[model samples]
Target: MSSGQQEHEDYPVRDEQNEAELQESEAGDEMKPVKIPPRPKRRPRKRKFVAGLLAAVLPGAGHLYLGLLRKGITFIFLLLLDIMALLYFSSIGMQINVPLLILLALLIPVMYFYNVFDALQAADRILRFPEEHDPEDGEDIKSAASARRRVRITEPGISFGVMLLAGGVLLFLFRQKPPWLQAFIENSAGAAAAVLLIGLGVLMGIREVAKNMMARAGKERRSRRIGRYTASATLAAVGTLLFLDWSYGTDDMMLLLKWWPVIPVLWGIEYLLIYLFSRRSKPGGTVRRARMDLRGLISAIVLAACVFIVTEQEHYLHLWNRVSLNLTAAAVDYGEAEGHQFEKPPLVVPVELNTSKVSIDAINGDILIHRAAVEDIEIKATVWVDQLDGVLAEAIADQSFVEVSEGTTIKITPQSKAYGESGKRQPRINLDISLPEDRRFDLNVRTMNGGITLQNVEAIADISLETGNGELILHRIFGNVKGKTLNGAVRARNVLGDVELGTSGGDMSAWEVSGAMKLSTAVGNIKAYDSGDAVDVSTKNGNVEVAGARAKLHAESLNGRIHVRSADFGGDWEVYSAVGDIELFLPLTGNYTVEGSSGYGDITTDLPGLVIDKKLISGQIGTGEFKLRVDGNSNLNVSKY
Candidate 1:
């Protein structure tokens, strides 16, 4: 009975199940025949050209226009940082940091082009993968956007932090200048560069370490790049060596710069070590070595080229010295502080000889000759030695003396041959001499590294003065004066005879000369006032000014103006300039003939009777006796005094 009843019930259930299975199969077949439409294409962004133009004009403008707020702000911030750095370097007025300033200057164009290209690429990326469109691939687009956002935010923040750190370091250096830090700040570009590279390497190594830590924490499938670590370590090592040399005042860094071939050898060794250590066993039973990608190769090439250029340059190859520092108007504080100064007692010498001529020679000291009422010659010598003790200085000073020679010349020498034999520890000797003012004597003075001053002295003969690198001054000298210097100024006042002065790199001036004057300089101005005789002045690169000249006057300049004021038309006057103007002032009642011509310029006359015509000026105020000739490459102006 159960079999018969179950058969009927099972038959209906089996029929219903069969029908349900057939319906499901039919639904599956229908769905299989229908295919999903391809993801919709994102329309290209409008005004793409305008966005690029804006980016070209301003680094971050295009990114802002493309709705990338963070990226745009980052670009702008970097641009501003670059500008501020440039301004800071330029405004510092320190010529020593020129290389650093140039390096920062080059970042301007690099950042500009990168920002433009990045903006364009960002627009293209949006066109290819719109955030809101393509619902089927929404997850992929979101992940891609998230990755880009992370990179944009992380890199800029890291850059900003690095800049802040550098600024803080510089501020600290400027505020607290320690003894060792002075070497770094004393016009040594190499030290600063080393610090920069070391800081950058440290930052890079820290970034890589942080990335590895984060990857491990997130269980991300990422392999570390060995090239980055190698580069960072190399930079840090090189920078450390440079810093050591600079801080310790050693010549090791300079030697390294000269022997630049060692750099390539070291680089090869680094690569060999990297190859040996970077090998890793893979899952396929094979070993793999690290390989530099395109980015690394480019970076290495750029860095090598920069280093080679800097090291090979003649100017940057050597460290700055005291002479060079002084040339640039920088004080020789470091070098000067290395010496010990010592003063000795005065040495009195009686002039028992009937000689009226006195001569003094110094190796490295200033000489001052003063007029005194004493009958004997008084001498005071000051010495400076390289050693800390005063013994060397006193020894050097003891050997110096004054004596009456057999040739009737009173000889005063500050240092003897023993001082020269002292080698690098040789001392500097400065002398002060007092001579009798009632008697007229011939003065002869020469110095190597010191100034000469002779004031209120009655010289019976020509007063000769010469210096290798110091100034020469003559005041109230009643004789012919001759002065010459290699790198210092020449000034004379109240000279009673002919005056002759010449310098290679300093000004020459004479006031109230009672005789003819001749002044010349290669790189400084020439001025003569109240000359009683003919005044001749010439310069290669400076101005010439002559006032109250009653005799023949001649002034010439290679690249400066010539201005002459005549008290009377008593002699012929000639004024010329190679690349500047000529201005002549004459008395109104003089009988003079004026002849003036200017090349590529006009000649003007403010006198009542003189006129300028066709770049030439020629006229006469009365019966022509004296002659005035002015010629130059620039303008020429003649006027009445």
Candidate 2:
């Protein structure tokens, strides 16, 4: 330890002596002084007011000015696409205007903020990092001088070539004399050209992408090999599928293979074959590999064939046994005579309609008979059915007659031949009647599976229509109507009469109604718009929407919503819902009487005159001529401007 310490101490002393000697030598040598270079002056950056303005008008314009051309172009393209989509959707009446406006509103501010930020940053960078221009070499100077000359000469030649080629192609295809040959050659050439162009473009794009990926990967042989193999396999599979589909008409094969039962059977057979082949093969042998390859090829071929057969069969079947019918005239006859007392017999004793007078009923398969201008008639007819021929024969047969002593009485009896051996029957009759203008008729029509349409028909007294499973459409009717349907919609348009519609399971819609409207449905919505009188709509499980109504509304839904908008209530408005929202829009000036209650909901109102009594509101607005009441057991809200 002592010897090591002595050596360490002696090393410091030797270093001090060497330093002294070096300093003495330097002093003797007489060193020269160093000179410092001056710093370069920084230039002021130009203002980017134009760039910022452009960017404000179009997103990414400032970036384009800053030489971020790729990013700038991408942003501009996306912005343009978004704008076009917004405009297209708006023009198509998609009702996405509010959401689009909000998005655009937000985007504008964001774009402006980004543009200003980027412009300032770009200007700052330009000011901080100015580029130095270098002197041009002889070759560079020559190249620059020749570039413009070359472009000037090449531009005209390129333009002429493109125009000549395009014109020649168009003329060859369109100006050919022979029609069939021209069409064939033009279609073939066009298809070939399109395929070639698309193929070349795809090949070039894929090659460029592959080159970039390979360059980035450097010498990573494993990664490059895997990438190449994966791309090659995918391309091969796609090309194979396309070739088979085109050359062998494999579309039908694919369809057949897609059948529900066929797919499972094929899959099971394939797996079973694979299992058996694997069991028979030796481990790590070429035989197993060969078997696998053969199985895959066979499976693909079989599946393709199956699909083709199914597709072709389905296509053929779809083109069979389709019937089309156009109606020329349709009329309905109710047993009524012209100008006859309700209790008087008809003047014409034997009322008969010839076969030529009636048009054959082919559309809905319904027999129609119309009495032109007869009154006070009695029709007692025996309707017989030929069981052997399945034909209905209706005749008086000397036993049946209809005696109309009073108003027109029309009676419908089921023919005996219409029944099967088991006594089951089917009613296939559709009747549409056009009553005489300014005349009234009481129609009692019944059908099992047919519809009755009455348009421009008015009953001065009362109109009643009943259907088992068909729709009843009443349009422009001016009197009271009572329409009932078992399973079809009841649509009344421009009806001036008091309407009462009932449906077991169909929608009820009334538009432009002048009188009080009442509708009930078991499982469909009730929609009324532009109604002048009070409206009441009830449904077991359907929504109710009333718009532009100037009368009191009482709507109830057992399991749906009630929506009312722009309503002027004469008295009160009530809406009941079991599991849906009640959205009501009322005028700010009208007084409202609201009685709302919910078992598990809130009752809210924005009206100043609305007085809340627990879940009910009974109040007056302005002159307070009418009282309003709305009662329910759900969330209720009232709002006024």
Candidate 3:
């Protein structure tokens, strides 16, 4: 230590000797004074204003202009994603969670303003502290505290990205609408909300845990904050209530609305009592004020909004019904639910046709055509309505009448002004049209929210019938038939012409048809018996049974069984089912070849000489002239009867 001090003490003596030698040596040359450059000027305020202007024009452009590449790129991406999500939700016609949509929509403006403010703040920081705000020295600038704050600020973006991605996937699925997803959407609205809330809570809890771990790792003081779990707890409770409603069809939403004051009370208690207690009992024996959490307030508002919406959805529906006339009162079945009935006086309208065709277009009513003894077409109209007072019903019925235009063809239609006022609460006009037996008039009838019944009317021309939400009953019709309904059944018996019928959610049954029968339904059974020429039957979610069908047969069912028994195979037959069995019965003496295949199912045949494997069958019965193709996911049974 003494030697080191002596050396330190001798440093000044050596320096003085060097200085004296230099002064003697510098006598021959001149030494110039050193110069220092001035500091660079601060950036102009005009440039800062331009950056803010760019941010106002577009979210992240100002950040890019200010040379903050990472922030600029992130903000731009977030803006694009937000705009894309908004456009998707607005354009998509599918049923969405409206509350969630509104919340996301609210975030767009919040994020936009945040971007502008952040850009301006960054520019100001750069102007004030140029050395500290070096964009190129991002790694050096990102202290642990700043990095943590950045993570906290961007956490909402991560959550939003997850939500947007999920919503996009759901929207895609809704568009495609596979059976399972459709069912889930139809029955689990509350459950879906619950799942969303649970996911958000889990993300928040995980974030908090990660932040605590990070702080601990950095040896920072850990302070337990009140309302840290309050938001999560509140969301969980509300989500559980909604899920219970969906699971058990309960009125918990209304119950929650009734006792909603409890939530705020408990939230206040946690924020006040717990925070004060935790502040006093510190781990290091030092008191620190815990920062207030506004998340609980936000969560409470969202929960209250959701609760009110669910509880009073019926009133909103009624208001919507009033605003949107396209929404029919038949949607609510006001006729049965309102418990008031009114019937108008019957009106008989005699129609005379110059041509052979008679067309009837009616709305919110049924059209019944019957054989009459009179020579001309006699129409008896009766109007029945509910949910209207006597005065309104009388006025509606007085304006309702059948207009018969006897031009080249006879057109009979029921018109009512009530359709404009009360929407589908307009009078239900039931027309009993009695057609003459001698005059063979072609019948064309179409109606909405009502049925079409043609009973024992043999038309000379083609019989065309359509209804929007009612059945098409064709009994003993002796003409070519074409019938369609969106939400009702199609039943045709003893039809002596080509039959083509389709329905959306009702069964199709054609018995003893003398001509070709083509029938289809989206979610109902199809049964065709004794058809001719050709027979095509298809259904998405129901069974298809054809017996004594002597025609070209094509039958398919997506999730149900298909059974075909042919009196005689007139043409090639093809039958298929995606997830059900297919049973084909042929005549005992037929010259036909059969080929069948199955997936994970047995392929069996009782015919004489047919080779059959577990999943395939290919053989000829007699002459091998005709072809029969059968495919299914389950069993494929073929037998000769």
Candidate 4:
């Protein structure tokens, strides 16, 4: 004990010099200043109105000015393509379509406004915000808490299921072109939705593994949050992919459906994995029950309802074939051709030098035409007789059945002779004619109950072929070709000039035509491929499919489907249907504005400013250089090639 300690009695035993030294050290620590860190630097805000004005000069210049590289590049590429298409089509002798011009005019100004709006949004984004801190966590106080309120979705798996369910309903109500699209969605949409649900459940297994590893580092809560987000993202992506596949037509529905059972098996395996991981966690770590994702179950129910409406109900086709099945009226024969047919050596008649036009009128046989090697036009036909009347037999016996009559006109078909029986029955006759290839003359051939084939024929004047109950085939016709059939298909290939073909009860397909063309069918599908210029194709009760048609297109269908692929819209396009889905497959860089509506369905498309109102779907894709007006009662899907 020191003398200073004895004097105070209550203080610790210490020397006087030591106590004074400790007091001086305490005063020095109190005089030190507290240090405060500097706040982070923030980005400068740009004026939205000024940025928008710059965009008016070029489509994406405004966005580029605001440091958005991706959005600016996208806008530039789209606008450039629009200008290119317009100039290219103009050089091909095609007239500038009015609707297309108007669309381009409006799109330029609207884009300017949108660029300004986008820049305004970017300027208002917050760079840094308030954070959180726990008083008990002294070590964590040195770092920013980075606390933020996020939307904690309840059952993210279930939410994804609802998205898929809504998609199914939309697909069923809106019929889109490309029959493959509907069939794939109907067969595979369910499987895809189910797989996604199971995929989310599998994330729970991953979480368990991560939780065990994190528990060793005392970060179990972090692992839990990560797992929750991963699971939600998995489910969300699955639902988004379904819609993306429909928009791009890239789903492997057939391949995926091959092993649908694996979807459930994968979930079972995940459950086992989760169980093992949970056991490996820290002693005091919590383990919650893994709930079964209900998303798949919801998708299943919705898909079932949609399938019933699409297949068993036949909703789209019933618009055309839903007549009462009652057979109250007596059946009436459609009148079959009944007559004894007579045959003779094929007649070969040389046309007079002055002949310039040829006409053939046959009652019930096919008409075929080829270029004859001879110097003059020749005719070959089979003579038939049901009753063998005197006038008919006399006309056939003599080669005068076909002779040059009026100036330059050759009449091969004999005048119609009523065979005294019911006017319904006519003698079956087949006519095969050949003409010089170098000579171009007017030609007309008509048949009541047979097909017509014109091969490699060049006509200076109008060439017409008509059939009542058989197909009409035209190959390499150089002039204006008009072909029609009442109960058979119509096909034209390598037609050089304008062509028009129509069929009442069969399909109509045409290809390689160098001029404007029109083909329609009443009870069957219509397909036209590799043809340019203006085209008009329609079908009343069957699908209408067209590919590689690069011009103005007018396609129509009632109670059927309409699909257009790889069509270059150099002019206006009008596509309409009653119950069938309408699909227009254009290149990803296609520039057009589609303005139309659907009565009972919605129009689905992916574009910058797409607006879907009640029965109305309108949007500007790319630069909107062209106009595509599609109207349908069921569904309309626009896809990128």
lDDT of 4 by residue, 270-328 (tens): 55765565556455665533445455434443343332232222112222111111111
Clashes (N, CA, C under 3 Å) per candidate: 0, 35, 0, 3
Clashing residue pairs found in predicted model 1: none
Query: What is candidate 2's local distance difference test score?
Result: 0.51
TM-score of 3: 0.48
Q: Write the per-residue lDDT of candidate 3 for residues 1-641, one digit (tens) a residue.
A: 69989998777555788988888778645665556988875543436898899999988888888877667766776666666666554444233334445555776888789889998887876665554454544445447555554443323246446655765675566455466654565567567877777676666667666765675454565555556566766666677777777788666766765776776687788778756665564455666456657765576557647655643453233232222222333443323223233454544445555567788877677788988688677777877655567677667667877887875467887876554343645567778888788777777787766889998888785887766678999888889987777788889999889898887789899899988888988889999888866898988899999998776788999999999997587688899999998888888787778888999888887877788876789888778778889889998888886
Candidate 1 vs candidate 4: the lDDT winner is 1
Off by over 4 Å in 1: 1-338, 390-407, 416-425
What would the per-residue lDDT of candidate 2 be over residues 335-420, giving only the tens digit for each residue?
21121111212223332332011111111212222333444222222222233231222321122222222213333332222233
Candidate 3 steric clashes:
0
How does each model score on TM-score? 0.46, 0.37, 0.48, 0.44
- Stretches of candidate 4 above 4 Å error? 1-354, 385-406, 415-425, 606-615
| lDDT at position 87, candidate 4 | 46
Off by over 4 Å in 2: 1-416, 604-620
Span of ten consecutive residues with least summed lDDT in model 2: 320-329
For model 2, what is the error of residue 5's alpha carbon versus the real structure, in angstroms, after optimal superposition? 99
Error in Å for residue 477 of model 3: 0.7
Model 3 lowest lDDT segment of ten: 318-327
Best by lDDT: 3
